[model samples]
Target: MKNSKFAWLLSLLLVVALFLAACGGKEEGTKTTTETDKETTPEEEEAAVVDEEQVLNLIMTAEIPTMDSALATDAVGFDLLNNVNEGLYRLNQENVAVPAIAEGEPKVSEDGLVYTFTLRDANWSDGSPVTANDFEFAWKRAMNPDTGSEYGPYMMSGVIKNATEISEGKVEYTELGVKAIDEKTLEVTLEKPIPYFLSLMSFGTFLPQKEEFVTSQGENYAKNSEAVLYNGPFSLTAWDGTGLSWKLVKNDQYWDKDTVKLTEINYDVVKETATRVNLYTNGEKDRTSLDGEYAMQYAADPELLKELETSVFYFKYNQERTGEKTPLANVNIREAISKAFNKQDLVDVVLANGSVPANYLVPKEFSFDENASDFRDVNGDMATFNVEEAQAAWEKGKAELGVTELSIEILGGDTDLSKKMDEYFKSQLETNLPGLTVTLKEVPFNVRLDLDTNQDYEIQVAGWGPDFQDPYTFMNLWLTGGGNNQMSYSNPEYDKLVNSANNELALDPAARWQAMADAEKMLIDQDFGIGPIYQRGLMFLQKPYVKGIVAHPFGGDYSYKWTYIEGKN
Candidate 1:
């Protein structure tokens, strides 16, 4: 009996040992699985730690309105479109087209009218495949009269065959030049060979559109973040359609996204120059705008001074809005207004950002003439500052219209600085022209735009800088029936001059430049569609740690893409 009991105890011990061995094996397998799940290499661990404590905060001088690239026309629009979506080509700081979506520089057909681009299998922020049809759909829809797109004619006129005619009801939108050779290739044909054609592509009109989203959103298209898809370095979020404030977050699906280091970009819409300056001065912002009284104050600050050399500022008038502009309608009156407003005075006194006054459409330092100052004929006819001469011309304008009252309506920006300038202009106009009373109205940015485009107000004050390096960008607005030609000003001769310049003179750089300069003279020295105030200088106050920001004379068109905030703890 004792021997049997001892054998039973030994069997129990063996069984216990087997159970312990099974449990030990299970723990070992579990630990291996955990390690595999947590297996991040040192490089990846460092990347994950980026912005671990907080997001990088980037502040802009304006608010973002929409993420949809197809319809944006303002600076905010340009920023979002440039960052969140890319076209077949993109512009460098020099406004030169570089490959962004295409395999490389596009191949031009024998006719110079057709453009064939090979795609690089880009994906949307959502990881959806980007196809050639996207470009086709965007180009076609832009030309469709039903789309009511103002930029369509501005961008597609010469590039997309029949694009202008179709938008104007002469041809069907389907007849537009863009086509998809396949899912990976896009082809576009032009009405005429444009020398600045590639530059035009850098604008927002050439960016791709999702057909499904366009059809689904309709008027509300591009009105919100959720309604859009982006393939650029970032996806826009926290942005309203109104452009009051916004953010651009990294797009994980971008083909060349590995180089993008920004975690979040913050933009705030600030129209008041003083307010913008305060945001930067108070340490509340890493980067902010400078305008008006603060412009010169920051000019001496080396950090801000570097950016001020490259911006353009001008005054755009809504001619249709001015009812009794009969007197102001005279080309003499337009010229007089140009002469009466002492641009230098505004810059020296009103603008502290050290903005220089301008008398011409393009800046003296722009990319047109790199070897020399862009201000050729610095002794040109338009450079004279003759308030007394302007007074004499105003008298002639009054006599030509036979207006006894010589009344006019003027629209100005709603900001505090604009109000002050508007007041000064009012006093100056009354002081300069006898019997002329210029009624002043102040409106917000969007409403001001409506009044300008719809001709709701007369003599509205506005400004424009080029979207790219070409003068055609600014001059095209005055083309007959142009969406931007809020002034009912048109001349066949002027249109012919500009069109011919684009076609015949495009390849001849010197000749083309001369032609464009002549066209600018025709508008300013002739039709008087707009008043040149001051070519704006780019102004920003950023802490020294901010790096990789380059300013172009064209505008802030791509500064967002190339800029990086360094030491962003």
Candidate 2:
């Protein structure tokens, strides 16, 4: 089977710097403004000059949860992880797979099941050699049931030999497919051939972990800047685990440190749009994301840039609540909720960006068939809005639940945009559906993620970005008992289709594509398990001098390795 050419399609993609999660901590105190070249005015535009300190000051909407690749779930963690860690391959400037820690491309078996990779001698930030044994330990740890890595079971299972059994605790971790043949060599055996395997290697979950460092820290691993070792272009600094400010400094010991031009990357979590804009205007920040009316106001600004991201934001319903089945478990109720909300109004009015309303899970232009037809187009929109139909479904669901009135809470982020949208959904759902009350529960990103993982919410607003270039990256999340399936909504037929597409029909391109299409239809149309919202478009305000930062559609969003300050001597 051949890999899809769509792997690098997101190279042209840019997005607003929306952190994938919420942070609860208080915002750091604003940096005191320094004297600027007052001879220039706002009209001059050039007044916002580069800091010239060789530092990239930026704003993050959320604080990073952890640096440990195995446990990090959201884009914020992966964004820092992608820069501070190295895997066998990394996404290049073109968004295509490129060699990183590996000496070169891996050797494949004639059967297409085995991969042998030779490692390049590299050192961790602490000057310790990165050995193939490090990778073997990391892979096994991820697969171990005790590790509790969401990505390990979701991605590796059904792909790597015995990975499913190991994750399910049915087999020893030693039975997992990866092996360290020598200090400089690694061999991996997959259950079957996966065309996007190389791209998957670029994800942080596949990055190596030093056994000695990992065991020594145990629960403290990756808790703060000093807790973990860096084996990539930068090392994190000044992060006290819960603080709102952190820095990424160039790793002088990195194998390719000579090529890293940016010596420091400073980050501060700024939740308010006005604050971010003020910082950028005052030359305290190099970039800031725009939303709501800000996006509309800056629409004509020369510095304004709109990014079409291949990500989907949706509402995932938790079916199994403690003591009783949630109202979401009722198919009619789920369908009603899906239709009651107005997606068009949400994006046009609240977001006010170039984002598109989505009636399905996967975003448009995310993947394509060998014939060049879009996967989303082939699947068609599974959920659509119709007030009359929604009312009818609501009535039917009320009768089924034997209730005259019902109320539920919606869990969401604490960011300004998140709160605004949360209120909108609350109003719409409550107003549109009679005899229903919707409450908003907004928490910091980490808290929301914890609630989601525990399945403690009735309904939650969630988003997903592809980890690799394939429909399966999104499809695999809902597989019967998959790790990312926090909703606990399951359909046997859907599982069958996904399993068959992944394993049995993997080599049959046409059949595999059909199977995925069928599975998605079942998940959305038949089950109504989750409600589709929209595809995000980030409005970016970037300094023209900021150069070489790679905008990726999936896995971490941006890469800082090749990023440099332009017009600098």
Candidate 3:
């Protein structure tokens, strides 16, 4: 089964290769041969000499909530930050970590707890040189309790020395283990030897910020394109705090500016599928995503591109609301709802976008062991769909709570496809479990994120894409009092298993892997902390002239550094 799954993935990669190739040479050759048989007009000859426009117009499903690296918690913000900011390292086309701002490799201590890096000469968009102090200031700012950054503590705690203490206000942020030895040198001390530290450096949370620029803005920092500084391949422009449109122009001040191909990239938030498809079909946009029936309709289209992603969607059961335990706090109730929905049908019929039903938190083809074995295959599936079992559990839960009927509201996105999926879930739950009422509350993407952060909903359809390539990224979210644990689910044993995997078992590769696997099973099979839905798959359309857009299974979805325009007139 694993071999076949990998074969499927390889075929998808081949399709991606063809999509990026854009079928350029052969079509141009044939066109030239046909034109040779006839006399070409002077205007036609002149048109042939003109260069194609080096611009890319694209569509986004959601609006970017914030540009602040310390506060971003969604994909849109991360993707935007990824293009406009520079970090110590960046993931290459092959998803391997490579130095970006750092000169080369860091000199590591023999004990593997300290690293000293020599910074390369790079400049921000304003012509000031990027310095080691920028990194130190940014890291300390994020770790400061006053910043209220969820990712800061969640990502750096247990890894960086004194980070946990600084976030908890037990120590000052100045003592957070990062120091600027010189303008071009930075020294960092870690609590332990982290296996994925390089990959983590490429994430948005670790991106640098200029202290003067950020402080000058005061409350306005990163509120708009003009307020933020850029040091990456592109610089954001024409963006207001809450606008639906923005543009990214090539950053001339970037260290490797010569390698950038696209001069401008424009984006507009489009929520409806019909509008997105119309924009693509009318040649107003270079790319658009397909959903539901559109995905099936374009399955054989030459412009269609499909990729199975590493992200997974699930039902987050909020165990507590307003300091009171909710019905979802009961293990039986959570388990009943988890097993009530038909995930296979949800993917095949409702989604129809190459997605697969997911029974576990960690996705397949994502994380691997030291021996190159896929983690999903080793752990297998857990808590799959069973209507009869769901019914039995629901009765028991109702009896325990002394209730004949129960009502709960689920919060989800207001996108056209999202509404359809929400309606289907409501129908399935209400139909399978008698005397149960499911209410749907659909809001815009940004609004939904706010609600999730406030824990204002009873149940929410949430999704997570890995910030880095590791099983721990998915497993760590449910830790006791974790920043991302908005659902209020906690288990001491689960915490012990996850902490040990990253601490005492850090040197033991096999044992660490086992501990993480055990934690995932415990979260799903035993506690029913969250219900797994489906592994995401993307099907989209791209113009033949567009090329070199690199898609990653983790972190920011696509990188446009090497993307370019070609054959189109």
Q: TM-scores across all candidates? A: 0.83, 0.90, 0.91
lDDT per model vs. reference = 0.61, 0.77, 0.79
Please write out the lDDT profile of model 3 over residues 121-174, one tens digit for every residue: 999999999999999999888887788777777767777888878867798988
Off by over 4 Å in 2: 1-52
Candidate 3's error at 530, in angstroms?
0.4
Q: Where is the poorest 10-residue window by lDDT in model 3?
A: 19-28
TM-score of 1: 0.83
Best model number under lDDT: 3
Model 3, position 12, has a per-residue lDDT of 8
Regions of model 1 farther than 4 Å from truth: 1-67, 93-95, 308-312, 317-319, 322-326, 367-375, 378-383, 507-512, 552-556
Error of 2 at 365 (Å): 0.8
Report the C-alpha lDDT of model 2 over 1-569, residue by residue, as the tens digit: 00111133221110100111110100011112233212344334332334455689989998887788888777788788878999999877777778899989999999978999999989999999999999999988987778878766665776678886886779998888999999999999987665556666776778999999999998899899999999999999999999999999999878888667789999999998889989998989999988898888887776665667777778998998665789999999999999998999999999987778988876687677778888888878778888888999999999999997999989999999999999999888888999999988999988988998889999999877766556766676787776567888899899898777666676677788788889888878878888989877778787766766777756667778877675434
